[model samples]
Target: MSRPIMSKATALKISRAQFDINKIRFFDFLNYKFRFLFFCWFDLPCYFISKGQYNFAARVACTELSSYAAMYFLARWNFKPTLFVFLLPFAILRLGLMIGNWGQHALVDDVDPDSDFRSSVTLIDVPSNRFYLNDGYHTSHHLNPLRHWRDHPHAFLTAKDRYSNEGALVFQIIDYLEITYRLSTKNYIYLARQLVLIGSQVGMSQEELAAMLRLKTRKFSEKEIAIELKK
Candidate 1:
């Protein structure tokens, strides 16, 4: 697969910001670049339906509608006075869920993309994990989703070699939100710096590691997903 260089727009964007990551983040916030994606709930039902999963899609659609209806009724049908109040927490929760998922599964290996360890990430020292209860062990969650939260880290440690073989990525002192931001901006240099070398990756150079990470972030086609799923 061909790797993409930064686009002209991206070049201009970085230039305008003087290559500052914080400025890029601020600009992206003003642009609502990820907000639409963060509201993944809005398109999910339609997405499922398009893939010919009518039952699950219908349930999702109906449940979403009913939830909104309940919220509106709770607000006494007053949009200005109370709708924002009701939506405040719900929107926050939804955005968090979507953003976490995005960050978790963002770096799927171009090869072996179907491997759970290869697809999701393990985050250490992320503050939200303490509050959200094991949100940081997303790779282990994907490995066996029903596993109790407390056992997640243990599981990863036990299968450390497998994770290393699958080329799993881990980060310390970085939360999912920052992961999402870094990936969105294609800041591979920063990501390479943060990578926790589990096994085979110990001797890799920053450029080589960045290239691998960049390749993982590329969008897979339906054909690619279908191919991956078969194996």
Candidate 2:
């Protein structure tokens, strides 16, 4: 059966929201900065590894791998033993996830660049004000996190859009891992752990640290969590 398309109304709503978010001071700049920086960072290394300058391919790998890492470490607190037990398996899994993501980059070439895209769900980013749901199962997981794999399509159908073939595979990996994490841990604590991990790695500045910690913002809010999910 053919997949349902995003209705014009839904698309317009999502697009407008995206535009609104894109116009946000912090998110607009932050999104572009990270997207470009990571695109260059990963793309260059991938070139050395792939022996060619397939920059677009590298960017997609970077996006997928980063998304997978976010989903993985954000969800599960489990640790795998390394040469140093204290070292934990998160690093190894993150590396493996990136390599796996690089392999999956091959599939991006299979997609039509002109393919229309829209997200059914919406996120209000108080940070950059950029609305995002490019890989949307993250949104689905947030909405009905208790739902399992085989049951997802039923839930997804309720949403106005679904991923194309290539997008589905990437989303599935992240979604499954996310679900597993939801089943194993409390969402807020998991989020806090993820915040600390990302904060430490990025050498978060005071402003960025305050933003992530919401120290200036007060109690954690779902709306805030939704914004973080998009990042």
Candidate 3:
């Protein structure tokens, strides 16, 4: 599969066009620049690290920490009160994670069973309809950040859409979230607390969270499936 690269032209154009001219103060622009530059600097390193190069992981970590430092300096520049307010908790958690030894366990990938030991989705390599945005596995995310695989008709209609057709191993989102969130928030009590708060804010009940966790680790038993079907 062809890997996706965020185009510099696209990034700049989007940044300038989407941003409010009057609203973006000097500090806001600086923060935006910080985020963009950090993304650029770490992009290649992240790819290399994902390829199993330990040295690349170290380099990426170093650069990522530096980028976060830059982001901190530029945070005050942001003028979007609403965005800043919404981002504060996540941002603060991220910054804290970057500092502690717990940073070693930072979660990088999506919460997918297919993502656990390896990738879950298998695609046709023809690259015809694959515009890298709509179909290009990873690039598609850049194009449509919120488009979920489950929402696709081909996948949603079938009992084994991602699992069988795409060669993906489907698992409960709650399961993925619990493991990843716990690992990422290790030693970061504020983040741990924030996670609980976020869970509550999202309207997930404790029973639901436990059920998801159980599903994540438990293999799919035919009996369970039968029981679910009966319900």
Candidate 4:
């Protein structure tokens, strides 16, 4: 079967443009960038929908449903319907997995999409690296895409000095969700404290960073505020 082909350069260009456009809104950016779950659950389907590719979206939806049905049937064969309720938690778990990617890449410099170190966040602690199979060393993974997961730590360690010099955002204790919550709550000061200073390199100012982190308040004309208050 013949398949569509796109060059790496073309794909990167599209991806970068999409990231730039989506980063204008926090939730939109999260949806566009995070795809760390069962493949078609959210992002892939949403991407198709956004592009008006309804046939592709429907195929993805059907595939997900089929997978769930297969699991349900397999479980049902071994357990009672009441016991099948135990599987409910897996659905919630999937949602959590979907959110995981957002936290990993959230604070990285999307402005320089071409540079892996600048575009990805790295988690330094042991627990995250072990649990995720060194997925926490994301910049390393991007730098060496075909390297074994077990080799990520070594690769990251070798380049640790360079990453630090480049102002890569490295979180020791916290995960992505915590960062997301803080940003969502308009805790800009805390976020600022955690940020690695890549603004100078990226041509992003502290004020611009602050604006990006501040989500709760929206600027409005006096007339608009009065109208909203009335409603």
Candidate 5:
């Protein structure tokens, strides 16, 4: 059977065209200057609002705020971490989640670059899944946002064959942060070494996997994106 395809990659590419948030400097910019106020007030709303975006907003506010908020109230809370708990959705956590999203959706097949199955990655046996409700199964989330988190492992196992066909990236002993870091540093050898091959991919050599990964991470030209969108 042929691999499954979805238009998410096209949407993701168009979204990424404006910003390369993978850089640590970009991160510094977001972290400094409370620039996120601008994101909250103007940038994001002017751009788009997905439920995931709102979920990210709420999740950051609820999670990080408590720890930071507690610290602030107890002592001389740095005006940065405490008073801005609510603003974390825009600042601290938004920047963080963008890194995760970049890692999750970084690899795109040159021929089928717009296909969700070809673009997103899944990390297995990663600790983040334990803490964040199976967030390692990002490809599954992209496949079906409504699917329960507990069911992701089962879903992935059952559909392993399809995932293999799509050449979907699967990793072990790593999380999105590591993936993002490795990609940013151009560490394809390590990434390929860590990649968990499935089905037809079982025989792929390390060099071949590294080459494929390099191709996956390359930015498609405007003409390429236009052609993919037209498809």
Candidate 6:
């Protein structure tokens, strides 16, 4: 027997319906938090697996296992205890990166999930793109996922107008710490103020935008929210 396949429209309908239901129950807050955590921990492995990159996954697993073994031996014989203690901050920094991934794409456009420009934010403040290799131009990277990172800025510049029209969110003078801190503190108003006409493009009134930005508010019913989104 063949398995049933859902059409794109059907999938989108179901997704929208679920979005509405989550809004009604005020479950989106918890859902986003949980998704944020899951993405941090498992997104890379799961993405590789989903793309049938089994060899990549195997290599990563082996590399991680070998690193663990090396660390164990280093602590047991070669490394001083204080050196290991000093490395703890680096471990915490890695953990923080997991949460940072969540902040990057947290405010995806409701009407354009697959639109690269609308679905991700671009971080513009970092002095140099050397460490991240211009990945701060996220929408450009998304538009051409396999393109060389060095080419991202060109891609972004080439299509700057379209991105602006689509209401793509860009942080002109903010760093990762600012993004993470604002989100952690539920400072949505401040964050929303930074958005470029997203409220108007999404047909969200000021009040509705505020309500949507809040972490735990359900001022609109699921039907109403869905209607507004469809607009």
Local error of candidate 4 at residue 104 (angstroms): 2.0
Q: List candidate 1 segments past 4 Å from native.
A: 1-65, 229-231
Instruction: Please list the C-alpha lDDT of all candidates, in the order they appear.
Output: 0.65, 0.34, 0.36, 0.55, 0.67, 0.54
* Clash pairs for candidate 3: 27-77, 28-77, 133-140
Ranking by lDDT: 5, 1, 4, 6, 3, 2
What is candidate 6's lDDT per residue for 1-231, written digit by digit as tens?
Answer: 111122222223333434442233346534544543334234445445756877666665566556556666767775676355634554555557544544554554555544566556787656535576775776666666666778777877787778778767666566555765676666667766655453234666656554554522223346644554463
Model 6 steric clash pairs:
none
lDDT of 1 at 110: 62
RMSD of each: 8.9, 21.6, 17.6, 10.4, 7.0, 8.8
Candidate 1, position 79, lDDT = 64
Off by over 4 Å in 6: 1-43, 78-89, 128-131, 196-231
Query: How well does candidate 3 score on lDDT at residue 105?
Result: 17
TM-score of each: 0.70, 0.21, 0.25, 0.54, 0.70, 0.62
Question: What value of lDDT does candidate 5 attain over all alpha carbons?
Answer: 0.67
User: How badly does each model clash, as a count of residue pairs?
Assistant: 0, 3, 3, 1, 0, 0
Candidate 1 lDDT, 45-143, residue by residue in tens = 655665586776787668777876788787876766564666777767666755555566567666665567766789877786677776788777766
For model 5, the superposed segments whose C-alpha errors exceed 4 Å read 1-11, 14-16, 19-85, 88-90
In model 2, the clashing pairs are 21-129, 21-130, 27-128
lDDT of 2 by residue, 1-231 (tens): 111122222223222323232123445434433443345445445534554546545665776677657655645665443223433354455544333222222111112211222122221212211222222333344344344534444555554334332122212213323422332232323323332222132564545533432221122234533443343
Q: Write the per-residue lDDT of candidate 4 for residues 1-231, one digit (tens) a residue.
A: 111122222224323333432234665545543443344456556666765878777887787778777776868687655344646566566667545644444443434434566556677664766686776676776676567878877887788778867756555555666765664466666665555554342565656656654421233334533433343
Better of 2 and 3 by TM-score: 3
Output the lDDT of residue 91, model 2: 46
